[model samples]
Target: MLMKTIFKLLAVALLFASCDDVEPTIYNGNIGQNDTFLSFSRSVYLLPVVQNQTGEVKVVFNSSTVSDVDRVYNIEVGFPEASPANPETFTVPASVTIPAGEYQGSFTIPGVDNGLVDEVVKRFTLTVTNLSDNEYMDNDTTTINIYEVCPLQADFLGTYTIQVASEPLGISAFEAGEVTLVEGDSQYERVFNATVYPGYGGNQQVTLAFACNFLNLGQSIDTNVTCDVEDDTKSLVHAPAELADRSAYDTNDDSYFELTFIEDSQSDCGSPANTVLTFTKVE
Candidate 1:
């Protein structure tokens, strides 16, 4: 009876141990009985540029091989026949080489110059072929998008009614004012000038410097704004320096400004009061 009981315990332990060794299977359709497979590192790449730039595309193997010598691979780049920026606009390498015992290789596309003034997005495609070894290329291709950075200045330069308020402090019903954007010192800069009247019986003239880009509307006027609230009295408001957070947008032929201003010092009204300003372009 004792020997039978010991055998049963041992069998149960072996069963639990076998179950613990089982691993979840991750299905990979690209991997087959062969150990070598080539594929692009990414499917899409966005290249934003104003002048000339270089972009790289990487080719990786599923598994590294112990090669004594370098292996070469041929790649083909295809561009839209109707693309205005065609072969003359860009150049791609004909092939890439992987060093011995390496699992990856890269190809460079050079001389990507945006000479055209027209703001248009261009794209090209790449495929891997002609493997030096008896390896297979995965059924995948990569697409490269080239975007020209054209500043949208004309779209945002106009007069608009702006309303400034601080709801938490019960400040509202302010007088409407106009804001305008003039050409700045550079092609990417804009001078933001506005005069706002607050319900708290004070006039604030705001002059901010802004940066313009193709990705979105215009960004903050400047890093900070110094306002002379009263005679011989000046206050500073910390503004966002980044483009995305502190920018204005245009929709349906109307320009809009949604920004927050944080005071640098305490005032009689309040300390650290957040002021939100919203503006709409007037026809």
Candidate 2:
């Protein structure tokens, strides 16, 4: 009797251990017929412009069995239905191989700056072609967006003294103080935090882009300061000035440039459009 009990306990322990070692099989739901599937790790990819102007896209092999030898899969890269990117602007690999005992691999996509317009996003599609008699799963296709980007120019980033040169909404909406300009997404943009309305109790990150001294004001940011007593949902807003003169920056002197913006431009506060805050650099 004692021996039988010990054997039963050992059997239960082994059963639990085996269950712990089992790996879950996540097949593409579109094709439940197959035990193995090939999929892109992401549905969308942003190709960052690096030193070589190239980026890698990861491909994952979802299978319970790991092969001892490398497995190669064919891929097709083409433009989507309409408004496809220029064929000459980008290049992708024809095939990617997963190494022995590895479940994932990556393929390099070379960025070709062949007259590609800066800041224009172009899209291309990548599909894994070897699955289930050429029938692809939903996850097998991935879209990639590429754009021409110039390197960040270092001269524009730093701390500078700021003060309102013009206020169309009200007085003291922004205080005269120092603010820092940091790097933005592309070479033409800069980001900074300004407390446009202290009564609202938060500083909003302001991003502005410029080309040839012409300013591109970013979207309005929510100050979360409700001006309407009836509607708590309505809050004050701040954005780069839409005014023509203040919107333009002075390229002749970066040390003394100006930032203009409208406070309560949306008229959330009853006194909207009363102030347009223009900040001039002092440093």
Candidate 3:
């Protein structure tokens, strides 16, 4: 009889302990907000340099509230103080209209290749105006850049003997061996892989940009080849060594081409200036 009474007492305690209130988690903040605004999708747009081509720059308008009527907004185009875009090279629309029951719309800025120079980048600005019903967002204005490019007249795709023609600092950038040239994503570009440092494990992807008889190493590449064993900070880097007179190719000749680049461009080890490499097409 005493054991039965003890079991009943323990059951009553457990039941009372499970009855404590949890108190629902009260959220003291708003779940969402409704905002209406208009702005450009991007701050900068780069148009390709193909001849007789037209590029499109898109603008986006955003809104949270829907209406039964169309919403119209005005746009103003202007040129920056330095390196302004020529008026004849591009066209911008004065206004854009968004249909009702839509949250977004897009408009294009038509950029023509006329009057665009081969090596120069032209810039223009577009600003949103006369938006009475919607607020202008952070990126209200956007800049567009246009340039000219010469089409590839001939193919330079083949294996070639690449040699370190000029290494002023006597640091051999690569082993004089055969490297294959392949077509890049565009007609004005050719890509190859080579070891920029003597003992680097892998080859680095290198791009050569050609424009109107002018060619250069497209951009800087990280070799990951350190100068010293103890110093991880000092590494060899390669970048475009653009020589006005020498860094060029003959469009009529596909047999050979030369490229120049800077080894240890930032002088991580020392002042190793221009490293000129020659590529002779292999028959």
> Lowest-scoring 10 consecutive residues by lDDT in candidate 1?
1-10
The runs of at least 3 residues in candidate 2 whose Cα sits more than 4 Å from the true structure, single-residue gaps closed, are 1-154, 240-246, 271-283
Off by over 4 Å in 1: 1-34, 52-66, 81-85, 150-212, 216-283
Clashing pairs in 3: 49-149
Q: Clashes per prediction?
A: 1, 10, 1
Model 3 per-residue lDDT tens digits across residues 26-131: 1221113333544454445544466677655465555544556777778788899978988788777887777776655667666677756446656788777776
Instruction: Report the number of backbone clashes for model 2.
Output: 10
Q: List model 2 lDDT by residue over 1-283, tens digit each.
A: 1111110001122211111112224443323344454455544455533333433333333343345677687888878775577767667778878777765667667666555534444678887777545333435677775644344333666887777765454434566688888765444557787775554344656666554444544445555554455665565566545435444555555665555556666776544443434444545
- Top candidate, metric TM-score: 3
Per-candidate RMSD, Å: 22.9, 17.4, 20.0
* Whole-model lDDT values for every prediction: 0.43, 0.54, 0.62
Candidate 1 lDDT, tens digit per residue, 1-283? 1111110101122211111111112233223333455555544444444444333223332223435466676668877664434555556677777667565566556435546422354677777777545454444356655544433434555676767655433434235567675543233334454432242233332433322232222221111222332322332333332333343443223366555554332342334445566767677
Candidate 2 accuracy as TM-score = 0.46
Taking all chains together, the TM-score of candidate 3 against the true structure is 0.54
Model 1 residue 142 CA deviation in Å? 1.4
- Choose the strongest candidate by lDDT: 3
